[model samples]
Target chain A: MLEARNLSVRYGSLTILDNVSFAVGDKQWVMIVGPNGAGKSTVVNAVSRGAPYTGQILLDGKDIRKYKSTELARKIGVLAQDTPVGYSFSVEEVVGLGRYAYSGGMLSSKSSGDAEFVERALELTGLKELRRQSILTLSGGEKQRTFLAQVLAQDPELLILDEPTNHLDLVFQKQTFALIKNWIEETGRSVISVVHDLSLAKAYGTHALLMHRGRLVASGEIPDVLTRENLTSVYDMDVHDWMRKMLSQWEDGQSGNLPV
Target chain B: MKKREGFSLVTYLLFTLAVLVTLIFCVCAGSVSVPVKETVSLIWRAILGAELPQSTAKAIILNVRLPRVICVGFVGASLSICGAAMQGLLRNPLADGTTLGVSSGASIGAILAIAFGVSIPGIEGGGTVVMAIVFAFLALMIILSLAYKLDYTLSTNTIILIGVIFTMFAGSIISLLVTFAGDHVKSIMFWTMGSLSGSSYGNAVTIAAAFAVCAAVLLSCARELNAFAISEDNARNIGVNVRRVKLIVLIAVSALIGVSVSIGGTIGFVGLVIPHMTRMITGPNHKKLLPASIFAGAVFLMLADLVSRVILSPLELPIGVVTSFIGSITFVYIFYSSRKGRG
Candidate 1:
């Protein structure tokens, strides 16, 4: 389990992430959702130690700041958005780099126990076919898959993803969440993801944290936190009516062309 | 996998042999050309403590060419490896000691020694060497910290622009020193242009020792460098202690650059061109690229130094002139070819 207490992040004169806190239990897929600039990504940054924040982030009851980087790496992996691959590294090479923590040091390379993990990641992400292909030549969707496979190879206890499917196709988005869902079910792990797609979040998450303008407006079960009233208040819109209109377009027998 | 390792081992042996052959050839073919056969035989006999016939060729090879060649080899290796390591660490293809202004910063200290006739007590080129190192560290830290503050991803143009500005700043300081040197202006100017003419066994040994230690440290961080080649944030998320690795790597690189600049002046382009060539031939895996670049760099510099000495015959051309001439041309080609549209 992981928990954050009174987490706050300030950028000199402005506060990016106001005092906000949440917890994630084992095997729970917790979705943090809100409009743009709601500090969703900031929480992920603070949790990953990418940004400095005041307050305690505990993993297994120990402060995350106290854990060795390698120790924390074995527990948490992040697949961030828009991470560029500069060189012409092959998909396999990029995926294998995920085994760096297991490599035992910054310098050493070990493949003894990593081949299987990398192979599985490749297979799961549908990247096995492109393992030898240069990452530079891959499309955005394929590149996203490459990075996702890399995080999969990391094999962390808690996977943190921030809009990880931004460049992915709809099918890949489903596959990625399903893959993480399967991993959580099998290993009893957890995932904390910040997603803007409400339907995707509602369909996959076990719990939800709703944020607004750097504040946590609501938190609880997916259904309770995403209530029409809370959504309307936070978004300043008729959230249910908008959703109904979008869903109506996909309704069966309306177009008489395909089943929804 | 076993086959691959064996294949790499053979390549390494072949590369080492090439470096050795180049070293001997450089020793043999100088202004006073010593025959290759005689050069090898004499070197072997000398190593075994056997007396050789006293000849002009033997004297030239032993007293003049050998030390300069050795110094060139180590300086070449250090500069090339430092360039490759930095490119990886900073996640920018354009990154190198010369481009990053570390070399220019280092030359300032060397110039200071020449202008003021300053020498630290009991240390050979003590003031120059120590000052070169201090200024190199200061320059590298300034560039890295400022780059970090300005851009999180270390964009190619931004970092290089910063380095360009830093190099200009250091150049102005050197110009100021030269203006006041009075009689030492020629010496300071010549040092900035770079030459291995005054090289001695002491300088070669110091550079070799520093190169060995720093190469070991950089080689140890190959994985971290590989992670860094993607992005700093990605490196951190994957468990690399970005700050720690960056500190260790930059310090080692700075020490190597300081020692090289102090001993051989500020040789340009060998660092920039050699690593780019190495990546093209050997691929981007630092595990292989780092070692390959070191060997390739040593050989390339020895050849360049030879060209510098022989191209003008009796009068010597600055090694820096030779390298920058070739390096700038090659860099333009690489840039237009590989990074044409992507950049």
Candidate 2:
């Protein structure tokens, strides 16, 4: 299980996240949904220890702050939104870096089991064919999958992703979500993802947290937190009717696109 | 895994062979034209238990050319290794020994020592070796202090700009000292233009020792440098102490460049160009790049020194001129090829 209590983040004199608290139980798939500037990414960043925040984050009932980086890496895997360019590492080499925290200071030497895990990560991410290609030559969606492969190679008990579908096409987005969903279902790992697309959140998420102005306005099961009224109130846009229609169509095996 | 290891081992063996062949050719082919048999005998006699007459052949082969060749090789390896480390630390392919202000600072120190003839207090009677080490360390200190004041992260543009400005500052001071001290002007000029004519056994030993020490220090941090090759935030996330690693690398590179400049006199472009060529052939992993660069750089300088001596026969040209001319042409070729590959 992963939990946060009274998480607050401030940059200089301005506060980005104020008193945000939430928890995801074991084997739960939680999605954080919000509009722009809602501090959704900040919450994820705080939980991952990427930024300084005044709060307590616990992994498996132990305070995460007390754990060393290698220990933390063993427990949780985090993928931030920003993807760097100009790196010349091949796909397999990049995935191999995921084993760095576990390589125990001898990064060049690999155990036979570590190699198998890296191969399995490539297979799971559907990137076995592109394993030897340089990372700089990959398309954006392929790059995202490469990062996903790296995180999966880490084999963490908890997975955290920030805007994992931003640069992906529709097909890639669906494939990626399906991959994550299947992994979580098979391994019974806890997942927390910051998502911008409400449809993706409704489709794959088991639990949802709604944020507005850096504070959580709703948190519960997907049906309870992603209702028509809550969407309208938080986004300040009238999507209630459109959401209801899309929900029904999605239920009936029809496309879920709504007119703008 | 087996294949990759085998390939890397083959490459390493080939590079070692190339370096050995180049070193022998460089030491053998000079202007004086000592016969191969006599040169080999002279070298064997010097190393083993034999008595060879001190003729012009033995003097030229053993006393003059051998030390110069050794000095050139050591300087080349040191400068190129420092360039590789600096580029990795700054996360820029264009960073070099001079980009971080080490060359300019060392040149200034050498010029001051030449013009004013000020023997430092501690090493007043220790001759040129002590003076060189002192000046080199002083230059390193200045550059590191300035970098610290400017907030450890110096952008590529800022670093280049500062390099130019500091070079000008040091050059002006040297010029002022030269105007007042008329007798030492020629020596100072020769040093500034970059020459290996003054290399001796002392210089060879000092530079070799310093290079070995500095190389070991930098190689020990290869993993940290590799983590830095990704990104600072990513490196930090993986528990690398980014600031401390940067400081150690900066000091190591500065010291390496300083020692080279003190020995070989401001030879440029090998530090900048050799690492890039190594990266092109061996990929950007520092583990391979650093060792390959050392070998490539040593061979390149050895060949350049030979050309400098033999091209003009009786009149020896400064090795710097030969290196800069060849290095620029090679740089242009590399730039064109990389662009073409991209296109």
Candidate 3:
């Protein structure tokens, strides 16, 4: 379980996230949803100890700050929203980088076990066929899957994903959610994701946290936090009826009718 | 996986062969050309501590050409390795050892030593070397801190721009010093233009040792450097201590550049050209890139030194001119090709 208590992040004079708190229990998929610049990513970043915060973030009842860099990396693997890789690395090599913490972070420190993890990750993410292909040659969906495979290879207890489906198409997005669901079923790992797709968030997330203007607007079960009134006010739009129709459309097996 | 393995193996073999051949070629072809027959045996005898022939040949081969060639090899390798590290650390393909104003800073330090006979007491050329290292690190630190303040991140563009500004500032100071230098101006010019005429056996050994130590430290962090090549945030999230890696790389590179500049006087473009050239052969993996750059750089510079020596036969060309010539040509080619690829 991961817990954040009154977390606040500021960049000099500007407050990025203010007094936000949320907790996710074991194997729970908690989706944090809000409009752009609502500090949803900041919440994920603060919990992962990627950002300095005023309040404490506890991982399994221990402050995450107390953990070593490598130790924290082993426990919590993060896949950022916009991981723009500049160099042309092979898909397999990128995935194998996930084993850095266990392998001592050296060029020759990888063991046979690390190789096995990479292979399994590639297979699980359906990237086995493209293992040797240059990542620069990958499509947007394939690249997203490549990074997801990398995170899976990390084998962390907690997975923090920022906009996990940003570059994905409809099919890859569904596959990504299915893979996360399967990972939770098998490993019982907790996941905290910043998601823009409310329908996917509501359909897949066990819990939902709504944010607005660097503050937590609501939290709890998906239905409670993603209510029509909450969605209308936080997004400042007439999204309630549209969201309801979209959710019903998804449930009715008419996913194509929903907005991307 | 198999292709990458085979490619690296072939590159290693090629670079090794090239270095050996270039070294032999460099030892043989000089103004006082050692006989082709005597060259191999002379090198072998020198290596085995056998008495060299009692002739001017021994002095030229052992005392002059050997040290100078070895020094050039080490300096070339040092520059190339530093360049690779800098490019990775800054996440900029255009970055090289001198990109952070190390060369200009070292020029100022060298000018001070030449102009006022400023020496560091114990070590020969220590004053220039120490001052060079200090100024290089100072310039780099300022750029890093300024970039950090600008966006709370060490933005690559900000660092590059600031480094260019610092380079111009150092240039103006060097020009001022040259105006007052008068008699020592030619020597200062030669120092900035770079030459191996001042190299000795001791300097060669010192530079080689520095290169080995710095290369080992850098290679140890190759995995982290690879992660950094992707992105800093990605590197941190994957458990790399980005700051520690950055600090170690900067210090090691500055030290390497410092020692090389003190010994060889700002050999231009060996750092920039060799890495891009090696990167074309070996991919961008620092693991392979660092070593490949080292060997390829050694070969490239040995060949350049050969050109510097034999181009005019009697009057030697400055090594810096040769390198910059080669470097600018390669830079233009790389730039054009990359732009073409993008379009």
Give the DockQ (2 decimals) of all models: 0.62, 0.27, 0.58
Off by over 4 Å in 1: A244-260, B1-7
DockQ of 1: 0.62
- Indicate whether candidate 1 or candidate 2 has the larger TM-score: 1
TM-score of 1: 0.95
lDDT of 3 by residue, A1-260 (tens): 78889899999999999998788899799999999999998888787667788988888899998987778889999988767776777898889888888876455677557877888788888888898888878878788888888888899999999887787676667767777877888888988889888988887799999999899999998989998899989988877677656664334342221111
> How many Å off is the CA of B12 in candidate 2?
3.4
Error of 1 at B153 (Å): 2.4
The fraction of correct interface contacts reproduced by each prediction comes to: 0.73, 0.13, 0.63
Q: After TM-score superposition, what is the CA distance of residue A246 in candidate 2 from its true location, in Å?
A: 5.2
- Fraction of native Cα-Cα interface contacts (under 8 Å, chains A and B) also present in model 1: 0.73
Choose 1 or 3, whichever is better by DockQ: 1
Between candidates 1 and 2, the one scoring higher on DockQ is 1
Off by over 4 Å in 2: A55-68, A106-108, A240-260, B1-11, B109-191, B220-227, B233-241, B329-343
Per-candidate RMSD, Å: 3.4, 4.8, 3.2
Estimate TM-scores for all models.
0.95, 0.84, 0.93
RMSD of 2: 4.8
Instruction: Report the lDDT of model 3 for residue A146.
Output: 84
Error of 2 at A73 (Å): 3.1
